[model samples]
Target: MASTDSHSCVVYLVDPQDGKKGTVVPDRFRRLAIADGCGVVGLESADEDGGSQEELTGLIVAAIAAVMERQDPAELGGDGRAKVGAVAKQAGFKVTKVQFDEAWPKYVDGLGADDEDKDGE
Candidate 1:
């Protein structure tokens, strides 16, 4: 939960019955919430930048809400997406899905070695 002395925000990753997980990013604009039943909640942030705590809070809130309304965390990277989803939910943002093929290469250190040539072939 991200919070100030008077307000706080919480994000939740919910796994409803059907053996699938869902994410809920709460908008910072929203302070109170009621969970439906199954899910995990994570708090993202709580601080003001340049005296715009309220604005930042609102952006977080909207982003989380957008994510919950438009994304499926399972599609991104399973648990990682779930965690991000929770944070987004708490902050009120939507999870943006990108093509893995395009994004993976940038972060992947090395391609797997050929099985027959394990000696750095």
Candidate 2:
């Protein structure tokens, strides 16, 4: 999601069940998360830029986890989104929600392409 002013983009990795918030990490650590649940991660572009989308996503997720781990548990309570936002802001990215209406077509196209690839195989 790009900020209203177009300065930054936000990606939300919210939990579908209880709206638990997080981001995408590496395969090895994501496997661990399957059992332990995802921890929050936020990354700023200034710290380091990844060469690929996968690398950048992994960095964002790891940073969120690191920031959350340092916070006081009692302060976090049930307000996971707030905590995630705080971390993201501190990292220098402005938070903004992406509109589902605008985003859905890209997802559908991607999924369709994936299906076509499988059919070809």
Candidate 3:
């Protein structure tokens, strides 16, 4: 296993059955996460020039736990779309329902992908 080095990585410590909320994972401990049940988005490791290295592209954005949920697109109409879209749109693409639906589960590094296909829920 690789140690948590200068290059950061988000570690979402999540519990799907729990409430939905996020918490920060410090840079030093960011690279550390244990789960087939969490979402991790990488940020760029800032450099002296206010940018990061080309080689070190992904930095730890956040580390959350016991809170990641498999978001359903139908639930977007109420209010959550804005929150999810912020991240999806940041990728520099037009945010659409189809795209968001596909991307939501992957955000958790396949945590939601497992049982969804098997249980037919």
- Candidate 1, position 99, lDDT: 22
Best by lDDT: 2
Q: Write one digit per residue (lDDT tens) for candidate 2, span 13-54.
A: 784555756655554343234223333355333333222333
Model 3 — TM-score against the truth? 0.23
Give one digit per residue, the lDDT tens place, for model 3 in 10-112.
4433534454444455544432332112234353445432232221112111111111233545423464432434433333223345544544444555445
Error at 105, model 1, angstroms = 37
Can you give the lDDT of residue 12 in candidate 2? 48
In model 1, state the lDDT of residue 23.
Answer: 44
What are the clashing pairs of model 2? 40-64, 40-65, 41-64, 41-65, 42-64
Tens digits of per-residue lDDT for model 1, 60-114: 4444434445556642355333244453454433423332222233222222333
C-alpha positional error of residue 48 in candidate 3 after TM-score superposition, expressed in Å: 41
User: Which sequence of candidate numbers ranks them by TM-score, best first?
Assistant: 2, 1, 3
Q: Each prediction's Cα lDDT score?
A: 0.38, 0.43, 0.36
**Residue 5 C-alpha lDDT in model 1:** 45
Q: Which candidate has the top score in TM-score?
A: 2
**Which candidate, 1 or 3, would have the higher lDDT against the true structure?**
1
